[model samples]
Target: MEGLALDTIIAKAGARPAAALACASTHLRAAVAEDAVWRSFCARDLGLDAPLDPEDRPLPSFKVGKRLREDRTLTNYMDAYKVWSESFGMYPLPLVKRVKLFWSSLKGWISENFPEALRTLSKGASEAQIRSAEDDLGFKLPMPTKLLYRFCNGQLPFSRNHFEDVRMAPLGIIGGYVFYDHSVNVHLSSLEQMVEETKEFNLDLEEQGLPIGPNLALVASSWYHPKTFILNCSSGDLYVGTANLSAGEMMPCVPKSLIKPTDSDMPQDGLLLWLEEHLRRLQNGMIKIRPLKTSRYICLYPEASPLCSSAVTNGVKVRASAVFAPEHPYGGHPGTYLYSYSIRLSVPEACMLGGVYFSSCQLHSRHWIIRCKDTVVSDVNGEGVIGKFPLLLPGQDEFVYESCTPLNGSSGSVEGSFTFVPGRVTQPEGKPFNVTVAPFPLQVPDYIF
Candidate 1:
């Protein structure tokens, strides 16, 4: 009730606020395991009459008033239950998919409309065979690669599959999410419909006078470096990027050298151009090869630091750019692709990414993303923010992964270990919110898997 940050509390509640607040979110089981106070509160106030609705479950005492600093306790306890249930869940709340849809749509519209960037090939291939297609297509791809590409091409086949799964997700604070398409949009609601509204988007970027005709599908670090991404949407002729959240006209990532893949150092006598021209010829039937000129590769979305800028193979610079897309459509777990690459290729002396494709052969579950810096770790009761490794400050300790056990003889508790480093990200202001929730019983999965 008294330990979490004020900004976090305000973020969880949505909208910027002047009021100071604190909370220690926990699962019903963890709440019981935490202290006798939570158990007594539950027995006396909640589960008193019947099974609890998710939105009406009891939560730990959280102090959220700027003026009434000490009033963290609840007489009804029902408010605690409702707030916690609304904020905490084993699967996502069926609404966060908006983040996925918006991004997927961004990719879909671009790739299909701006086909000049990526070379397209057959879709729905096995994990093993995808490599060949990518090699055939000639570009690294992100998860759901074919899906995002099709969507960009104006086909929305997998749109339903991408949005329907809510099991792997956890509710967000302030529902904090940043988005882009042809326009810079901020998502503020967390509901099924608003989640669906992102897809109905068909705003003519051309109507807005954007570079909708540019056949350049690229992945750049979002103007905002909130989360890393690897994207491949065919950006319209108009190039866009975000500036820090201070709010001004969003600017394009400068040094055009930063985002686009270049062969200047490894300049291969217009190899890139040759590849493009060759692909056009292949499509137009002007030329033919015994097999083809295609390849599967990964796109690294590195930080904008100079260290990231100097990526090379055999001392020759390769393409590298800004951080990952804030809302990557191909699922945001950059590690899966990185780890998979580890199995196939040697680590680059200095590797950074812009985006990747044709890396994995199987269709990925884009719902539960791999752990990222902004991952959120909140308890069922909405009390404390769990801390984790590398995120710790000069002298901070790790919050070991703890169990979520039932309290007061309740039916069950939501539980899992998530890492949080207070000063590590969103710096000088906000921090990353990486969280992992156990939707099913951990014991069952541990032994079964």
Candidate 2:
């Protein structure tokens, strides 16, 4: 054993037996419990330093050290370690303390950085109002939710052009799904309206194979898509629901069908935790920002160069570029200029680019016709760039495709997005999201700005 490598001897003895023997031995206890032996064991098994007192008065005992090492060997523990390592800064405090800290930090940040963007429909909700809303809904609001209402009755509408936008509901209308209440109406939904809407949405969800728990309430909704964010009042878990736009009209005469619920990858501690993480990311520049007002097509992901733009979301990068072929107009039709567009997509993580969609303002307005070879590929109102959709493979980090759009006008533009599907077998119902396509100019070389 002395001549053999430590790992070789350990392998011969086996992990369990060696650990048990080390714990039980009294004669060789001094040698087995040596600082160097425990340090090596800790490093090898747990990828951590052995525990020791500040003054080094008492080293970790064999049982304690072995227990820690053994715990790391468990699959669940390893997974937890990976999450903790990745999210340490994102969630540094426990849920109870974190919620308070988050609200305070958010208030200060908004006041300092976005004071004009902050508008309240009313002062904080009174206890009476909270009780009435809860009683009407048949569920008590979570404490974090209550605390948030105390800060602001509602928030002003700020454009969230990117997929990673963080939007929270005003306390007055926590259960409302419409974005216009914040943007156009500048008012929060009353407690009575919230109850009515939640019940109605829940009924619709039941028909969609995702019946909302009585204790769960809608917290926020995305402006960019038909997705609703929800939180369980009792469990404090967050969930997302995407509308099945293809499911036809929500008419009573229509037959009911299954509509999937998309789960957010955020922690389950509650809305407070989710908001805190997002705000922290924004403060630290981890999140990208697109201006609320812009003349250019909303660049969801800004580009480093004017010719190309890229944006990364959920571990996928979507890049776009364009080339003009003014001399080669489609169908030999004069005034119809040809533009070549390219999408360079990369999915380095465990996700796939399920589909790509391209639409232009000019195209939507019936000003452009797109063609492939000699054939007319798209009418002005076509669904996407190419008539057919293609899937990006799991390990496929790079994909390039070119398409030509023929504009009837001398100058116009084209822009759209890519859809990403997560690569988890267990995530069958996961919803896809759009990675925005930066707008590219299509102009005749002689056309002046």
Candidate 3:
């Protein structure tokens, strides 16, 4: 019986007649439960080493083999096996250590990629401050949150907006105050404030009918619009609460609840995980910050008069400035000026830009080339300024574009016009019109004076 293969022996046992079974010879149950049998089965099925002493571990080879045969699901079993193997004689790293390591790596990455933004981060909070905050809030902060504050108290930019006006509160105000200085529409509240507001709104939680737990906390907020990021302190879950505001009243919270679970739409993760994921998204271009207005101006360019057609008040305003680009020059033209142009256009209303045509008075028509991001957009008789056109919104709205053109002469000027088409909703019968592009000087700095 020991020499026989396990499958052969089982087959033989099953093949016994009724009478032979009544006369029952061998201890088949004991044979099946034998250590050797289970060890072989475990090695064959799970590819795990058979334990020398089965009593040493909670999940022995016999139990593992039985589970594998009965369920045949490997995922859960593999996870358990990994935990059991790795944690045999070691304890996991403390949460504080793990968090410190994560912040260190994140800070290093931010410094390398966004040095200006990195400089805005505040110094770490002291242990006494952390304890005081915990006492005031009446809830223990998560280890990761505490660890994060140890590196940076909060990120506030005084002179310039960091990361495109996205500001984060200091540890003290994250749960209590809302930031209104940066935006007109958005407001972020703390956990205590959310709870108080929930009561102030006279919202019927019972009628609202979602699992409104007591563990809700405000993690982050954005004000460009009314959006709030929340975290469930108990379950480590995440939510986003958006409100429809009218006359300072929240329309979205009127009927059912002031705020409800938005599981389907929001990222479901802890605070630290969400921050890490957000940084990753920013790095990957999943997140973008559209510049609201132009930041600077150069006086070297002659401003083109605002061009207007029938019924348009201020038509379209265009401005241009030129700078030297040493990195990108005409392939073989040495001493030839490589001037990069920054152009901005302010549209008065919602309209579509059809195309832009570039012309130069100083450089030859053949030498004039419009290049974007080091790639040539058009040369001389080119079709458009860029491959794709964009639609601009109304009221002091601005759109920016950049292009590089080479000149054979020491000094030259470039001028162009943009084709505009008013939105059909605004002017149902309107046709496209041309707006003058401001001609800016493309002379080297040495010759500017």
Q: What ranking of all candidate models by lDDT puts the best one first?
A: 2, 3, 1
Q: Provide the lDDT at 88 for model 3.
A: 26
Which candidate wins on lDDT? Answer: 2
Q: Of the pair 1 and 3, which is ahead by lDDT?
A: 3
Poorly placed runs, candidate 3 (over 4 Å): 1-98, 109-116, 157-213, 223-225, 244-269, 288-290, 294-449
- Tens-place lDDT per residue, model 1, 1-449, is 33345323433443111121113344322322222333333333333222233323433343221222356643433333334334332212222122224333433433543332233212222333434444533443433332222222211111234333121111110011111221111111211221122222112334455443222222212111232111222321112222221121122322223333322222111112222332333333222111101311112222123312222222112222222222332322322111110001112232122222111111111122222223332233322322212222222221112211212211122223233323333342233233333322111110000
**Local accuracy of candidate 3 as per-residue lDDT tens digits, 188-277:** 243334344444332344455434445554444433323444555555555544231111211111112222223332212356565555
Which is better, 2 or 3, measured by lDDT? 2
- Local lDDT at 99 for model 1: 21
Residue 186 Cα positional deviation in candidate 1, in Å, after optimal superposition = 15
Better of 1 and 3 by TM-score: 3
Per-model TM values vs. the true structure: 0.18, 0.35, 0.33
- Show pairs that collide, candidate 3: 175-190, 186-223
The list of candidate 2 runs beyond 4 A from truth reads 1-98, 120-122, 156-196, 205-212, 223-225, 245-268, 292-449
Better of 1 and 2 by TM-score: 2
Give me the displacement of residue 181 in model 3, in angstroms. 15
Model 2's C-alpha root-mean-square deviation from the true structure amounts to: 20.0
lDDT of 3: 0.41
Off by over 4 Å in 1: 1-164, 168-202, 207-213, 216-255, 258-449
